[model samples]
Target: MRLDGKVALITGASEGIGAACAAELAACGARLSLTARSEEGLRKAGPGALITPGDLTSEDTRRAVVERTLERFGAIDILINNAGIGSYLPSWSAPLEEARRLMELNYFALLGMTQLVAPHMRARRSGVIVNVSSIGGKVTLPWSTLYSATKYAVNGLTEGMRVELWGDGVRTMLVCPGYVQTGFQKNTRFGHAPDGVVKARRFAITAAQCATAIRRGLERDARTVVTPRSGWILVALSRVFPSLVEARMAKINGTA
Candidate 1:
């Protein structure tokens, strides 16, 4: 469970939580392979980290990233599927194509990368797969329904894979972070902040905080990580008081 000298491949490493995870893991002495659509922002991952800059939604890109990571490190001890896209519009009014595009990057790309890396992890009988979902995955947010749906799928996939890989000595961690300060909101498709979103941004945590939780989860062999320590209360409320939770979400989305 010690990350020292272990090789970790992190997607969406150009910035935000992904970059933070790379830096934290490197500080833990883990060798890193960082991937993103652009190389410029990846420099924050620090020196000597392998950078695979490309579109992760493409099969060729996923394959190349894995192959090259293996080529350099000989084995992947950890796989962090962090590359994702999000939508801020209401699902019913959103363009169908745009929804599908979000799914392609957020869900399918995560699945594709896991599939490519799982066998190697299984063969080695020791590895970790971290899927970066969201607090929205645990509790649907009306304003970003489609984005929530994609993350919900990731939650399910990670849970199932965790059980499947249990006996193989491979581990899966579901990271459901509350709102964090990052360029994520700015980069989201059709993601202009509305009044409610603007109000919510005031409470967002920093990306480094989320990254710290992820690293600690890996060390402790945790199944789920809810960042800022308090996000878990929302998850619990969603489970025990679904109606109330939905009402709160409605209020937050300015629909109440």
Candidate 2:
């Protein structure tokens, strides 16, 4: 629970879940090294911190983040892979190249960053990775298949990682949140959504609520974490009665 003096690196730290996490983690007493494309936003997270403004979609930028974190903090202890993009169009309708870019950030960059950090954690035999995924990773819906697919990839990555890191003393976890009230959805590039869907999504849990759940997951070292009572209840029900849950979610997506 206490992260006093721990060095943490947070991607997508300019705003939304990343910024909220920076605030929460800083309050928990950890020094933060935050990265995003926004220098101004990163500056706002200050309190004995280092901020890096770069595109996470670039391999060079991703590695530089790790290198900068190490150079600034001496060693990386916690990595919150919260940087990602959402596509709001149908996969086929979406631009192939744009989707590739999405994959670069949502899947490949996360994997590469983890690969870069895991060995260091393995060397120390201790570290925590909190990959920010989404509830759509756990199920399918109408449009947004590509966006969902990327999150699904994150889900798979997190699971396989836990197996590999076991007994190596490295902890890997996936944090899946449902319709977090953030600019991510509004600013999405593809994976189309109806206006009704967007409206409903706006009323979902706040970033702070999701960040609180993330802090708990890090503290407890959870395998997978979900935010808000409704989110977990749905995930649980999906496991308990998949068909029923699917039928219900279908209605929510207006697919039924």
Off by over 4 Å in 2: 239-256
TM-score of each prediction: 0.97, 0.92
Task: Write model 1 residue lDDT over 97-198, tens digit each, in one string.
Answer: 899999999999999999999999999898999999999898887888999999999999999999998799999999999889998878986666557877
Best by TM-score: 1
Per-residue C-alpha lDDT of model 2 across residues 99-156, encoded as one tens digit per residue = 8988889999888888988899999988998899988788765556788889989999
Q: Assess the local accuracy of residue 152 in candidate 1 as a C-alpha lDDT between 0 and 100.
A: 96
Look at candidate 1 and give me any clashing residue pairs: none
What candidate 1 gets wrong by more than 4 Å, as runs, is: none
- TM-score of predicted structure 2: 0.92
lDDT for model 2, please.
0.84
Error of 1 at 35 (Å): 0.2
